[model samples]
Target chain A: MTTATAPAVDSVEKPGARERAKRPGTGVGRPGFAWAAPAAVFFGLFALVPLALVVVLSFTRWNGLGSPEFAGLENWSKLLDDPVMVKSLWLSLLLTVLGVLVQTPISILLGVWAAGHQRNRAVLSAIYFVPLLLSITAVSVLWRAVLDPNFGVPSQAKWLFGDGNLFGVQASALGVLVFVSTWQFTPLHTLLYQGAARAIPQVLYQAAQIDGAGRYRQFFHITLPQLRNTIITSTILMVVGGLTTFDTVLILTQGGPGTDTTNSAYYMYQKAFKSFDFGMASAIALLLVLVASLVSLVMVRLSGYDKMRSTMEGV
Target chain B: MALSLAACGGSAASSDGGSDTIHVLVYGDATNKVEKQLVDTFNKTSKVKAVLDTIPGADYQSKLQTVISGKQAPDLFFNWGGGSIKPYVDAGLLMPLDDFIAKNPDLKSNFLPSVFNTAVVDGKPYGVPMRGTQPVLLFSNKKALQKAGVTAPRTWAELLTTVKTLKAKGVTPIALGGGDKWPTQMWFQYIYDRVAGPELFQKAVDGDKQVWASEDSKKALGMLKELIDAGAFGTNYDSVKFTDGGSPALLATGKAAFELMGSWEYSTLQDAYPDFVKSDLGYGTFPTVEGGKGDPDNLAGNTNNFYSVLKSTEHPEAVAEFLKLMYSDQFVKDQLSIGNLPTTTNTPKFLDGSANPAYSTFQYDLVKKAPAFQLSWDQAFPPAATTTLHQAIQQFFNGQMGTDAFIAAMQNLPAA
Candidate 1:
């Protein structure tokens, strides 16, 4: 081939060298520019841009319509004195604590029982998972019907208990709600605990039995210690889920009978969508996220998930 | 090369030129065959091909707003009269029909005066009213009334008396679907108008007077409380859906004595009871309160739906032609026979009767003799105000706030 033709071939083979050399910042020739582009774009747009916008918008008074003005933290300073926020925050914590305390032991007991029974385990598991199959709205509606003072199991229960029509508030209503929630979510924790329980070497239990450890003793020592990680994980989940509960509370009580049952999430919906106050809503959302994060962090630390593997490996 | 290819894949389909297609969005099931018949009639007669895309009524506002903001809006769509269309108007997303009306004077004159006014906002017409109806009378069952030995409630006192008697007879006096936030406000607003008088009610909704805390307002809330206490709303009141509540079980089963519903409810009841059209169905205004200024004849409600053309349309002329077809004389007659109060000035030839006897009383009260008409409170106010009113009603019902506080909260709300 002639020299000019050879130059043409080189041009074809190695295009954009001059262009690449002149590129700015990370530079075109470097792997950093090519590799970091997607992540950089994502982090900048999603994380940094939104965070900046939220911070700026937090101060401004915009009613989710029209252009927002630079109100200079007027919304933020107003957040300090909002009574709804205080009530909602307390309500959220109360629900979380109540849910966890009520649900955990029932889940644990069911988990332990099911672990020993192999024949009906699948059937039992399916039965336990039935609640998960129903959508939150459907579940709320079902429970509402089941707790109806005039038509529900409570009225039937009243008849059974001889309390009859004399009963004022259906005492069974709150209990039924808690029980249904546990029934719905317990299967998840049960499976986790069951898996963890099975992982405890059968030899350890056998050895403990041989060494004069009674069933209760073996349970307290070997079984409890072995399931610590699973319990901590499940507890964290239940606590967080309960803290952010919305659909059930909204559909069931609508924070009704005078806000007797309004949780923070439902309250936030009432404030935001129902009331259309984006500023107050955002403040509540941020507060909720902060509280959940702090609680989850404390839980992880107390559960020793930081050193969970090391402790497990040592064991 | 791959990135560009993916971008190409993500791109939306662009409409080619000369397409005769016009998209028309509606909400809810075409309640009757009226909308379907109208659309079909337009497509057959007109050059423009119109397609109806129906969304649930509850989600229509939010969905339409998104569609408009994204600039993928339909050619023509449904809107509530003028007030609800303001949000879109302010954004310059609605076509002004003044020029169209000027070009077609006959079409402009076709609509009733009240009907035409609903489409005019800021002295410019945006929507064309299709069918109008008043929500004045509630259909009541006489069997339940006779058993309770109570007369048809003509005043607020008579209504409460009926409630007590119905409870004694083991029937629910009234059925309300509080699960729908809008209906809860309906009960509150209905009482608000009846007790405070219609002028004050309109003034409050228009941001001129704050009536939420007026003695009349307190009386309304107190009346509602009385109903709740007397078992008017029934158990699981919060769980009932609106469409299901006002008609199905309440009017059809006869277990409930009265349903505070709109004129369209007559058809629903007829569907449930074959003889409903001929026998035993009585319609009247919400009863007046003792010593209250609210005239028994004061009205509340609007025609069912309005149609507006999108500002981004390339075919404004075609939209005007389509609206003319909808509001024309022939279309008006068909709609009126089916119990729709047509917006057009077309006279009806009713084989059944020129007057829908059950609805005429309320219509007369609304159109002729009524001193004032109170718009649906939610539809009348801006979104923020609507939300505040909803919350206030809920809070009041839950006993979270007293009547004075509720009024103060509404009175102090920043103007839209």
Candidate 2:
């Protein structure tokens, strides 16, 4: 009876094997083009189509009234001459770099520590994850209230805050922006690293222990190496998120104290909604998209992340 | 995509020609109930129904600009009535209200002339005043002023002295919501009006860029600089915002003695700190600048909100009938009940019915007596110029931009 059933199962599998052999690149259970069609269509309709229109709008003069008139690179030329535009680009880069530098180490340390199997670590990690649940607008408004000069935290801690004029100056305002973003977004990056850390094989650490490696040595040799891909993934997210940061600047600063905190994203909003210069805003938007894409691409290439190799490949 | 969906909805609603409804769009806020009531009143008498639509306040201007020329355009819509509607008027999307006024003269005459004239563009009436006038006033916490041994100032010199006195008492002399930028612009509007008179701004807005560099302009900047140098607003005004209740809270709590804001500040304060508004709030017209060219009673703020008709509206007669309600006695009472000081001729008769009778009477008298009511500079300029204008105002106040740089920025604004 067993031999008869085995032959029946083999006969059923033989046809599937022949089909797989017929199209060698089409592996068993792999989805075809039709599987991705929905997502692709959605992306085209929402993202690609709007991006193409924004490109077209960059070359046209539209005040959001009537139809757009072709202006023949006028908006682009104007942006080139705009000092605010130049300043905004630098500000965007500075804020993004600051965000990465500030958030990465903290996230990594927290993530690695939280990956432990202790009960207290789980509780603390849950508490730390609270910020990630709050909306960006809610986070910004909370920080704005907390940092208000006369009414907020600065008011209570006079010695520390020095009259609580944080938003009055450029440096402190930028600092507050970076600090708030770190406070809100570090949890998300930490979660990424935590998941990655837990996935590392216990055998590697056990082998390191057998070799008389200390905790620090084991972390550096085994854990750090394991988290390499996650670090890249997290940094890329930080880079993109920093580039498009808007709600925080809007609710907290409105790009004020004389355009001190006006990053590219906020500046684009100002041009589009505040100034009603859709043409100029479209130009800025296109530049941001290009810069973000180029940065992400360069980062992937530099990290060899696009190669899709596993961190544990040699092991 | 959402905008397109709205456009489709709007077209679908209006495509049925047999449907006897005229859409009336307004800026959505607590004030919408009044507009809704007014529309109900219009629909009661007319064969054509009046429908009220609102875009939330912040998005109102952008949404209006997008839909004004589309199939979604309303029959009549809310506007600030200066350069706010200039683009639409320039695009010929707005119908000049002269024809409506010609048929019913009260449409032009029932509202205050100054408030009504704000809607006149290129020598033609395009809007009728629908909402109240909001003249900027110097508001104070009386308790704070008493603690500082000072009264609300009546002249520019007295104001300076009051600031010094308030500062000596460890209070922020003036609560400038510099973070909101436009609140900062209120100072410029009053200062420029007093120092150069309304004609200087009028010339500047009418395409004479040279006025921004005129000696009068420099002198106005010098006076503002003197005020700033006096530490009148304290060092941290840029960290405060009235919209967020930061600066207003300062005034309410007696941490600050003064806030120069629009008449709307009364209601804002009432909402946030009713006790402070009831017991301590004191307001007066902006102090006179001695030897300045402008009249002391001249005002600067939003003149009034107006309803402008779309040129493509299918129901003009229905819209005109609806506008007539703007000046009716009930309209004035309803507006006053909401703490809005309507600019209709009959507004004074119902002042006692206002949420704050004394405040209403004061504002009514101020609006009536003012020689010139200068619209806020950001509103006077085309929408395209607001960011540059706001940035310049903020930079100038914060010492980020020098006088010459501010002048250049103003000169570079797209001509109204």
lDDT of 1 at B3: 27
* Candidate 1 wrong stretches, greater than 4 Å: A1-69, A145-180, A254-262, A267-280, A309-315, B1-21, B32-37, B45-48, B105-109, B131-136, B209-236, B239-254, B267-282, B333-343, B350-371
- CAPRI docking class of candidate 1: incorrect
Best by DockQ: 2
Query: Per-residue error at A156 for model 1, in Å?
Result: 4.4
* Leading candidate by TM-score: 2
Q: What DockQ does each listed candidate score? A: 0.15, 0.65
Superposed Cα deviation of residue B58, candidate 1 (Å): 3.3
lDDT of 2 by residue, A68-182 (tens): 8999989999999988899999999999999999999999999999999887887899899999999989999999999999989999999999978888899999999999999
Candidate 1's displacement at residue B41, Å, is 3.3
Worst 10 residues of 1 chain B by lDDT: B7-16
lDDT (tens digit, per residue) of candidate 1 on B117-234: 6667677888787665556466687766776787788877788778888888878787555545566676766777777776676566557654566667777778888877777765
Task: Give a tens-digit lDDT track for model 1, residues A1-315.
Answer: 243244444544676845644655323222335456788899987677755665665666654444556787667677677665676677778777877888888778777777875797878777877777778778777766555443456447865633222111223323444566776787788888877877777888888889999989998888888788788889988988988988777666566533545567876676666555656666667667788989889988877787776325544
Docking class of 2: medium
